[model samples]
Target: MANEHYAKFIEEAFVKPIRSVLIIDDDYPTLDEMLELEIIHKNGDLPPKSDKRWHDNPGRIKSVIDGFRQPQRPLLVDIHDGANVDTKGDAKVAAHLHQSDLLVLDYELDKNRPQDGARSIEILRGLITNDHFNLVVIHTSEDLDMVYREVILGLLGATSDELTEGEQEAVNQLIVEYEDVDENALQALRAAVATDQYLHARLHASTYMRTMGQGQQPYSDFCALADEAGWDNGNRRLVLRKLLADAERPLRARMRNASTAGLKWATSGVRWVKAESVFIAFSSKADHDDLFADLQNALEAWNPAPSRLFMAKLRAEMDEYGVVAQTEALERQHALAHWYARLLRSKGDERRWLIAESVLRHSDQLLNTILRRVEVFATELISSEAVAAGDNIEARCQEHFNVDLSKAAPKKKAEREHNAFVSSKSPQGWHLTTGHVFTMNSEHWICLSPACDLVPGQGATRNADFGDRTPFMAVKLHPVPVDGNHDVNSNLYIFVTLDGEVQKFCFNSQGKEAVSPVWRTLYAERRGLLDKDFGFKISAMGAGSRKLVATIHPAQVVAQLRYEYALNLLQKLGVSMTRIGLDFV
Candidate 1:
């Protein structure tokens, strides 16, 4: 019955309003399909086929889907193995996820070849990371408490093992459904957690989101809380206890009210969809007065035709597109205009397909560029007096949004900037590829060996004649002091760029003398280094001394450094192959 709670709430809030939904399960909900399609999992990870509840799970979902009325029925997509998600991958799954108003996922996706419902979190996480707003509901006959706990921790970037003893205790205590706290509830929680035997109970997704999540902040503030707790016996447990306790304070009645509010909110999307329908209806059903009224409305909408306005927008909003991109875009506009004209003439499904096709044809960099511009614009805009009058950004926001953004404790500004250039990987990272960063004897270094020299099968042949079977060419990474007042924006720095001016750097300088004062100083020093110590300095690392700290992001090398700068760096290293420095220098 608890597992079936999903059908009742969904039928009431989702089905009636005709809200689009994406359902993910492992079965097609029929005896014939189940008999033919059910593949035995090697581990025997699920209940036996004889179990009525397990066998009839898909039938339950199908019943609710059947309840949905026709004549503008809600868009419903059912995904299972050999269905929407298959060997080709879940691109269609991602599209439906983005378009759907709600997501209904089975907690046990291990019913087929690709095991574990948790794996679906990877797709959901990717979408959320890109700032896609979404809600999710999980339905299963598994222990409800454990399922809820896993979903919360999984989405918020943590796992049960990462939790301290105290956090685990607090979580267990919170899951016990009781109108008021008592020794019995506390004992039940402890027993359930210890034995890993949890009982079924009702659950709600929105309640969890609003309760644990910090709204726009990623996750459920679980990451932030863990950071604050320091994962020690002290704070993590206390904060988690408070967060969970607060979540339980709201009753099931309040949950229903929130669901009601959401149903009201669904009307906005309905109106957006209905906007185009008005014209279609007008063409078919219009009498004399109706045609005249629509004509007046149509004229009003064309105050500055949307097409013309967007065309002039690139000129008016020059800062949004960097000068380089703006100059480059002029050549592409003529072709785009012709395509847009054809798109406008097309109707129905063809137009929608063309829109998707046109968007895909453009480079990802162009979309990413737009996003970067918007971030830059918003960051500046939010800090201004118009958004919030006071100077305290956090305090002002607490007043503005009623939720604190700082609670998420995301990667720091400086660290994120540095990471953009050098993608770091731990000792447990993938294969020892070229460009992997290393530190030995307190000095940073990079692998100068070709990728073939480190890859297992190819590397053996490449280094077969060397002193050590796994010998690698090495290059030193000269450090620029950026610890204190030293400007990270300086051209001397290879990684961290505080002001994002690093992108414009033409190998050494953006020049036009538009650079910061720090760059001017670094520029002269770099010039002097070339003049005095221009010779390439390479070293060899024998088999024993190859400990690595992190690996560099090659995409940065491909996108940003695959230029004359790379050629210059390569040429210097090439010319001095005859001479080299000491091991791990």
Candidate 2:
């Protein structure tokens, strides 16, 4: 199946005529595939259906040549065991090198061979230089680090030379930087060099450097040196060299990971093809999880009142763990601020209200700074005559809201209306009317209705109707555990209203497709309700119930409601919403 996939890929991708193919690998299966492809290409017909070769390999050769359309048949030059640098492999490659336009060189070859594919490429660098082939692709499952080093060396024109004075001095300096080094290993490396085993010496030296925490070389400096030494860009060697150089740089200012060493080549530039392993070291996973858990716990326990002393403490702890990246630290602080705000609302602790308020204010300032830059950019675009006069208002709106405003407006309104109705509908036996909006005058609460009996004489409430505005709040969907033989087949939608009310509604999971669109609309519009006045009209309207009923599980419902409320509060205060796990339902 894998061979068939590759054959089909080639047939479709090689729209232009392939003049010839050079298959350089010790792998018999790969060579056989190429040989069969070449035969099919020449015949202008696929192998007969009854052929046992096609049956054995199944779709491998048949799929590629069944409808092969190219008028020109490409000649094939197969070089088996080309990885053996000391053998006639070099002579055979050189003899047939000019006959093919494409070279498919494997990265790994026979384990018994002294030279692998990379080493062969390194040795044949001179012969393959200056567009010797129209295309050359390294195809292998070899370790990326080994491949990277070999490719760089090959591109820069590898040479065996007596160590220069500067190079020797650099090596010595590197050794000195290590607090401890194996004297035996160092002596062995020197002996290897003395015996003119330059390759073995370099390998031993590299291992020593790696063991002594000097594995990272100045990749940028190396690239510069290679360029200065006059390596040409005929095969995009310069581009690849630069990519490798950038990838070698530490992702964090002071911390480095082996996995990240050569990642830039894969991530940046025009990617032609890639083969990568997905497995990561378990230690890396453990470290990541530990750091994440610590941050989450710190955020949950944050108290920002009086000053941001709690945040300072968390930052110090994070710094000790070598997580001093400013952006990452600030993001954690922002999330903590939001998380704490929700706590204050749920607990209504007057003592901690000041702290929560302060954290929120700080978070707001940070968010404003980010939004201001976006606003400035948008304003500039809007002010520009060229953009304003264009017919792409949808594009402009997309730039602002990440959505097509013209298309979304009606849909958003419809969703909002549906959510309002759902919220007003009864859960078990309680029905609530649509909420009114009330803006916050200060951090303290203010009454929306002047004539209302809730609060007297503290503040004058003008008769203000803010319409059926849904309060900006965070919401989470949680599963309701069913009792044995129970019939409720839905989860609960818990909402934290703007004014700190923890409300919930039961939603059937079967209706998620209908509910998700409404929920998303509400979530998106929640920001608009910030610093706004909102209150819902509540009433009990089913089965002569004067108070909340026992048909629904109150304890379970309340627990989920509070949890969602706190989370929503954090989101409202600009906490990273990604932390909320709402997909369970």
TM-scores vs. true structure, each candidate = 0.29, 0.23
* Per-model lDDT: 0.37, 0.34
Where is the poorest 10-residue window by lDDT in model 1? 519-528
TM-score of candidate 2 on Cα atoms, chains taken together: 0.23
Clashing pairs in 1: none
lDDT of 2: 0.34
- Candidate 2, residue 121: CA error in Å? 2.0
For candidate 1, the per-residue lDDT at 583 reads 88
RMSD per model, one decimal: 19.3, 28.7
Task: Please provide, for model 2 over 1-585, each residue's C-alpha lDDT reduced to its tens digit, 9 standing for 90 to 100.
Answer: 112222222222221223455545454334555678779989898764332233465353333332222345434445444544542246556656555544555555555643354444443353333233234445454554455444433333222334457645554544343214443433333332231122222334344223222212322333343344343432123222223223323212222122211111221222222112110110111122221122222222221121122233232233233333324336667667776766656532232444545566655645444444334433443355244537875554454334555775544543443433443322211111112221221111111121111221111233122222222232233333211222322322322232233333333233342333112112111112222112222211134347633121111111112223323333332333333546776
Q: Candidate 2: deviation at residue 398, Å?
A: 28
List residue ranges in candidate 1 displaced over 4 A: 1-20, 23-101, 105-135, 139-147, 150-386, 394-476, 479-490, 494-585
Task: Tell how far residue 551 is off in model 2, in angstroms.
Answer: 99
Best by TM-score: 1
Give the candidate number with the greatest lDDT. 1
